[model samples]
Target: MEFGLVLQTDPPAAGVVALMRRAERLGFSHGWTFDSVVLWQEPFVIHSQILAATERLVVGPMVTNPGTRAWEVTASTFATLNEMFGNRTICGIGRGDSAQRVAGRRPHGLASLGRAIDAIRDLAEGREAVVDGTPLRLGWVRDGRLPVWMAAYGPKALALAGRSADGFILQLADVDVTEWMVRAVRKAAADAGRDPARITVCVAAPGYVTADDSPAALAHAREQCRWFGGMVGNHVADLVARYGTDPALVPPELTAYVEGRRGYDYTHHGRADNPEVAFVPDGIVDRFCLIGPPAAHVAKLRRLRAAGVDQFALYAMHDARESVVEEYGAHVIPAFARP
Candidate 1:
């Protein structure tokens, strides 16, 4: 399976660029960043630097929402990057989250997200597409290619991804959830008369490599990655509101932990010490994140790959940013290298 590195465009844009460059040297094929402009820096602006610095690392938002910018503008930015940097960019988009909510708006519905995907892909690929009843095309784009990947957690979003998106991005790494979502997307693709094998499956989660599997070390690793479960709970809460916690519709493994979730504080959205995520239990952290030694990570990755995961995007959001990347580059990545 291919490997990718996920980061938040935190600051000193150069730091983000350096990490991407380092990841590229270490064999990460893709570099991703959080795109909540209000919470963090603009990812597209930083993506340019990342693309320019790295030789072969593809860069894009771990997710940008359709509501934040005009569809044409988003397509134009991507087209410009691809024009300068070879078609080495992929768009991983989803319904609004911190990007929108922090700006005082609700997440856009799946319908809007679905349309944005088509319009952005078509325009960036040098094709004409109707956006808001107007025919729009990036006239400067020549042989430009942008694979639009949709991040989804609900059934409707999943169905839309299967029927339309070039890839599916699942933000967590639970094997059962990965298996279920992959089957859902692929089945939807088949039912929609599309080739299921053509869609790329990317599983992204916080991966913290510990020194050993000792309980104390494991506990520290879990605390650092606990923020992820809360980040994911923001989406799960939405699912529960719509799907009503049905095990048949939404897996209990996903919904059960969020029962104690009172609410979230965007100020601490993806931070390691987010007090708001204290309600996130250790069990949820263990299942949602890759927290163990390299061998343990390889074992879970093997299961994920066997479950049809084509790529695993490691979220280096904790304190051991460089160390985890180095470990994955040295131990985890080589374990799956093709001869």
Candidate 2:
């Protein structure tokens, strides 16, 4: 399986560039960032720096929403980057989340997201597409290529990803949930008369490598990565509201932990010490994140790969950012290397 590194585009843009450079040197093929512009810097601006600094790292938002920018503008930015960087960029997009909510808006509906995916891909790839009843195309884009990956957590979104998107992005790493979602996407693809094997499945989550399975070590690891459960809960809460905690529709392993979720504070969105995340439990953290030693990570990754995961994007958001990248490069990544 391929490996990718996920980061939030915090300030000191150089630091973000440095980390992407290091990840590329250590064998990460993709570099992703959170695209909530209000909470963080503009990822597309930073993506330019990352693309210029790294030799082969494909970079884009872990997710950008369709609502935040005009579809043509989004396609133009990506096409521009691909023009400069040899098509080394992928667009991982979602309906909306922190990017929209923090700006006092709700996420665009699934219909809009689905249309945005097609319009962006077509325009970026130098094809003409209709956006809002107008024929639009990036006239400058020649031989440009952008693979649009959709991030989805609901049935409609998953079906849209399968029917239209080039790939699927699942933001958590639970093997059971991974298996279930992969099946859903592929089945959707097959039912839509698309080749299921052509779709790439990426499972992204925080990966905190611990020294050992000792009680103290494990606790620290969990604490560092627990924020992920709350981050994911933002989406799960939406699912629960719509799907009504039905296990047949949405797996209980996903919807169960958010029962205690009261509300989320975007101010502490993806931080480890977010006060709002107290509702997130340790069990949820363990299942949602990769929190043990390198061997343990490899074991879970093996299971994930068996479940049709094409890539594992490590969200190095905790204390040991560099070390975890090094550990994965030295231990976890090599375990999956092809001869």
Candidate 3:
């Protein structure tokens, strides 16, 4: 499995080149960044910064929503980046989420995505381009054979990706769910006359190592809820339901949170009064995170690999422990992704 690291927000802004260089030295094979505009930094800008600095590592934003930029426009951006960096570029897209919705519009229909991917592929292939009646081409050798993948969740999207994309990224779900999605991808690929084994599976998950429950560590995990809250409620609810407490005592304040009705600011502080509630809760840390020690994190990755995961764009622990990451760089990274 290819092991990758996705650093969130500020840490990415300062010393990103150095950070990527360090990751490379530590044996990481690839790096990804979130493209969501508001909560984090713009991924395109961050991706460009890192790719420009690294020579061997495969780097790209984990995804950019179509709503943020139209199909043709997003295609050109990817093509330009690929041209500048050789073939080590990947372009991932997802159904419009907060990352796209907050920007303006959502990627409305499946047909749009199909057309978008088709348009990108066409542009990359340097085929006759009649984009809205305007002819265009990026000089064959092709615009750039960038691997394009879809950020997949449910059946419909997975099937769509199977038909079109070079691969797919699995976000915020358990191994069982991933196994199911993997099967779906394979099934769809077969129906499309393509070999199932070729579709790359990249997973994004939370992994952490807190030797003991430290205040600083616990707090950082809680802060990640700023974005994770909505995910638990919407996408990972099945896993959350299995691991969470009587959703009855979910702090009442967190109800709006689970319902996606709360704002980022309110959601973070809303559950603060009962902060320890999650840290000490039966399944919170385990279900939502792989927190314990290096062994626990390693075990989690092993389980995922067993489920047929090909790559992991790890969003480590809580971005709280620099030491933990350094230790992980020494231990965990080598085990999974040795560049």
Candidate 4:
């Protein structure tokens, strides 16, 4: 399976670029950044620097929302990057989250997300599409190649990812959940008359390599990554609201953990010390993150790959960023590379 790193685009843009460069040298194929403009640095502008500096590191937002910018602008920015950087760009999108909520608006519905995906993918790929009721196409894009991946948690969003997106991005790394969701997407693809094998399955989560699964060490690892469960809770809460508490509507696995989740604080979103994430239990953190040694990680990743995962992206959102990347490069990544 391919490996990628998800960064938050924090502080010095150069630091972010350096991390991406390091990741590429260490064998990561993709570099993704959070696109919450208000909370972090803009990712597209940074994507240019990342693509320019690296030989083969594909870069894009881990997710940018359709509500934040005009569809044409998003498509054009991607097309421009691909034009300058040898078609090494991918667009991972979703219904708005921190990017929209922090700006005092609700996230856009799935319908808008579908339209934006269609327009952006078509325009970037040198095809005609309609955006905002006007027929449009990127006149300058001759051979732009951009793949649109959709991030989803709920069934409907998963269905949309299967039916429309070039790939599916699942932000958690639990093997059981990954298996179930991958089946859901592939089944939806088959039902829609699309090639199920053509869709890529990318499982992204925080990964911390430990020497052993000792309770103390494991406890520390969980603390460093518990923020992820809370970050995901933002989406799970929405699912509960829309689909209700019925397991038939939403999987019990996704909604059960969020019972104690009173609310989330965007100020601490995706950070290591998100105090507000106390509602998230240790079980969820351990289950959601890859928190053991290299061998353990390899085992879990193998299971996910067997379950049809094409790529596994690590969210370097913790204290052990360099160590995790280095260890994976040295141990975990090589295990899966072609013989």
The segments of candidate 2 whose C-alpha lies over 4 angstroms from its true place after superposition are none
Model 1 C-alpha lDDT per residue in residues 1-339, reported as the tens digit of each score = 999999998989999999999999999999999999988999999999999898899889989989899999999999999999999999999998999999899999988998999999999999999999999978899999999999998888899999999999999999999899999999999999999999999999999999999999999999999999999999999999999988878878899888899889899999998998888889889888999999999999999999999999999999999999999999999999999
Of candidate 3, the 10-residue stretch with the lowest lDDT total is 263-272
Which regions of candidate 3 fall more than 4 Å away from where they truly are?
Answer: 9-12, 128-135, 140-143, 212-229, 236-285, 317-321, 337-339
Residue 116, candidate 4: C-alpha displacement in angstroms: 0.6
Q: Mind giving the per-residue lDDT tens digits that candidate 4 earns over 1-339?
A: 999999998989998999899999999999999999999998999999999999999999999989889999999999999999999999999998999999889998889999999999999999999987999988999888999999998989999999999999999988878888898999899999999999999999999999898999999999999999999999889999999987765777788888888877799989999998888888888778898889999998998899899999999988989889999999999999998
TM-score for model 2?
Answer: 0.99
Give Cα-based local distance difference scores for all models. 0.94, 0.92, 0.64, 0.92
Question: What TM-score fits each model?
Answer: 0.99, 0.99, 0.78, 0.98
For model 2, how big is the CA root-mean-square deviation? Answer: 0.7
lDDT per residue for candidate 2 within 159-262, as digits (tens), equals: 99999999999999999998989999999999999999999999999999988999999999988988899999999999989989878789889877888998
The local lDDT score (0 to 100) that residue 209 gets in candidate 2 is 91
| Residue 121 error, candidate 4, Å | 0.6
* Candidate achieving higher TM-score, 3 or 4: 4
